[model samples]
Target: MCIVKKFYVADSHFGHERIIEMCARPFSSVDEMDETLIANWNAVVGDDDIVYHLGDFAMNLADEDRVRAIFNWLRGRKFLILGNHDYKRVNQLHPTLARLEWMATPTTSLETTDGGHRVYLSHYAHRTWPGQHKGAFHFYGHSHGNCPPIGRSRDVGVDLPDVAFRPRTFDELTKGMIE
Candidate 1:
């Protein structure tokens, strides 16, 4: 049996041009950024893989259809972990985006299928989460690399060079977690 992989990334901020300058992203244009992000995503994320987007998916695009189309281009079963940029309620999202059937509820906490370790997912960095003290890992975004890990926690935002503008598997995010 083949095992489906799960990946994580945050604050892609897809259509936001200023983000490139703000985050010092290497791309030369917003189109380049968007294309590269999508390419990088599809390169690693198989059709059967799972992707957890920590939020700030796309912004500055007034067209809901374009926004939905952008999302539709990516391969995988995607989940959202609502960030400040994503609006407070799912109903408030653009009609098209809101209409898409996400794989699960935005709120999430789970056990790693690979390690059996508890994991919490969010868009904002939390000083403490449900299992923080007990060795559970917390992954979040929004600071764009400003916030350091409190312990087994860190920013999974796409702007971070280490993440390379693509979703990361649990193992990739936790490789150094053992030390």
Candidate 2:
């Protein structure tokens, strides 16, 4: 049996000082927020684990170094689902691009078996995603937890309480969504 562990997170918005004030993040400075986010992510994600970052990994398109640094600091094998803010900026640095396993479009279907469950991943939550009615669980990050839950679909954004400002395992997310 192939056993794979999957985790999900989104909208980190690293390096965006305005995000701290905008999101009411509990950090006094951008550096503090960045360190805390990196630490929190590394705490739960292991080296071999897989993480699907839904979108908005960082701000400041000009700061490619900061973006690459943040990517290197994070644990797990990373995959990205491009968000609104990620379009042009993410392509600026090809040097660190190899760190990611793959970069997907805003909406993509991920067919993987983790603990015998099928999962669908996207940047925005969908009311009716492919294979959703057939027991496929959908995970998304956009809307920042403001949107209501849709059937088996749940916002896996780090901004939400269920995720606790960190990447969450598939089992952890599913349990939170069911409750």
Candidate 3:
């Protein structure tokens, strides 16, 4: 039997030129940043993989077409956990919005099994989540590696050093958190 793979990523902030300076991203330009992000995403995520994107996907609300184009370039069956910046922009970008498997608000729970482990998904880190005491792993974004890990919860945002600004497999994410 084949086991499907699941991945997690967050805070890509695609098309946001100011983010390069704000986040101290290595890219010299927004175009370069966007290209690198797309390349990194495609490198780790396969076509069959399911990726949970924990918000702030893009900042360019003015150009819906460009945002849609960027989404088209990515690989995976993506589920969006809406972040602060995703509101008006993502809704306007119909092409990208239509392609998502599902979309939820910043604070939502997703109960799923990965690598024989139960996990929860959300956009913002939580002190206590559903099944926290029961050993259910929690994955979240929005803190962008600034927030400390709480209990079994981890920041799945791409801003972390371990993730290298790309989507990471479920096993990879859990392993990093465990270490």
Considering TM-score, which of the candidate structures 2 and 3 is the better prediction for this target?
Answer: 3
lDDT of 1 at 150: 89
lDDT of 3 at 37: 89
| lDDT over C-alpha atoms for residue 144 of model 1 | 92
lDDT per prediction? 0.82, 0.76, 0.79
| Candidate number that wins on lDDT, 2 or 3 | 3
- Of the candidates shown, which would achieve the greatest TM-score relative to the real structure? 1
Instruction: Estimate, for each residue in 1-179, the C-alpha lDDT of model 2 and write its tens digit.
Output: 53447788888988889988887888999999999999999998888888888877778756777788888889888887766667654444333333444544333335555566677777778888777777888888778778887888888887898787899888888884554
In candidate 2, which residue pairs clash?
none
**TM-score computed on alpha carbons, candidate 2:** 0.85
Alpha-carbon shift of residue 171 in model 2 (angstroms): 1.0
In candidate 3, how many Å is residue 125 off? 0.7
Quick one: ranking by lDDT, best first? 1, 3, 2
Minimum summed lDDT over a 10-residue window in model 3 is located at 100-109
lDDT per residue as tens, model 1, 9-77: 999998888999998999899999999999999999988889989888888646677678888999899
Sorted on TM-score, best first, the list reads 1, 3, 2
In candidate 2, stretches whose alpha carbon ends up further than 4 angstroms from where it belongs are 1-4, 89-109, 176-179
